[model samples]
Target: MYKIAVIGLGYVGLPLAHAFASKYEVVGFDIAEWRIEELRKGIDRTLELSEAQVNEAIANKMLFTNKLEEISTRQQLNPKKRISDNVYHSYQIFFEYKESYYPNSNKPNNQ
Candidate 1:
């Protein structure tokens, strides 16, 4: 099974993680501690996903973690990057994308 890790679990990352959780192992990562807690309780103010959908994702082995080390267990990540001031802030995290696993893919590696 494909292991997936989604960093920056905000509007985009959370939903994407939830979707992937239905098919693969998913781990959601975020810098904010409150975000993790809120998600654990199935709270999404973005109104993108219903409470049922959030809970189902959580039930499907979707772990929300703040510890960046947890991400190493996954093979892939969503291409969703954090946008700050209308520009993509890739500097939020440093990563190396490999072409072997996913050629021409925008998704980043779990490294």
Candidate 2:
């Protein structure tokens, strides 16, 4: 079976990961070690997926990690195949901040 890697276990990513994990083996990767630990304990601070959902995914053998290298450990199982071949899908979310959104209302002179 192919694997899917969902990077970012935050609001958007966690729900997507849990949904796909229902049918495929998923590797949920995050840069935050605390986030990974929370996930392992079936706690989702984002409140996207319930604790039951988290536990269900773990019971299905879904792997959660904070280490970047851990995401590729599965691909090592099939060195004969391309890394892309082992990973059937990858999903990620990125947020960009705009200074305009938060105008400098607190500027020393303005304040």
Candidate 3:
């Protein structure tokens, strides 16, 4: 299992981190102190996460921090080394879905 670090806890980062946490060890990082505080209390102001989800994340050892120094210290001591692997990592997922509907119902008169 690889260690993962997710930066920014906005609409994008939060979900990504949650998905990663399901499999690998994940660290979600953000610079906002208030955001960190909200996360600590199992509240997502963005409505991206329910209180239960946030609490579960916390119970699972997913860390949330505002101080860079503390984050660094914790990273160094992280036996899983998940934070190091995620420092500059990027996670992208592309899903292809086909729609059966078509727009512009008017037919062109080619005749």
Measured by TM-score, the strongest candidate is 2
lDDT of 1 by residue, 1-111 (tens): 337879888789988998899999988888666668878998876777888988999889899987765765223433463223222234332223344554544322322
Across 5-92, the per-residue lDDT of candidate 3 in tens digits comes to 6878889899887777776676787766678887999998888889988888877778876444444454455587656434423211
- Pick out the ten consecutive residues of candidate 1 with the lowest summed lDDT: 85-94
Q: Whose lDDT is greatest here? A: 2
| Backbone clashes in model 3, listed as residue pairs | 3-82
Model 2 TM-score relative to the real fold: 0.64
Score each candidate by Cα lDDT. 0.71, 0.74, 0.66
Q: Please give each candidate's TM-score.
A: 0.62, 0.64, 0.59
Ranking by TM-score: 2, 1, 3
For residues 1-111, could you state the per-residue lDDT of candidate 2 as single tens digits?
327989988899889889888999998988666789889999987789899999999998888987656666554666666565324333211111233464453232324
Give the lDDT of residue 107 in candidate 2.
30
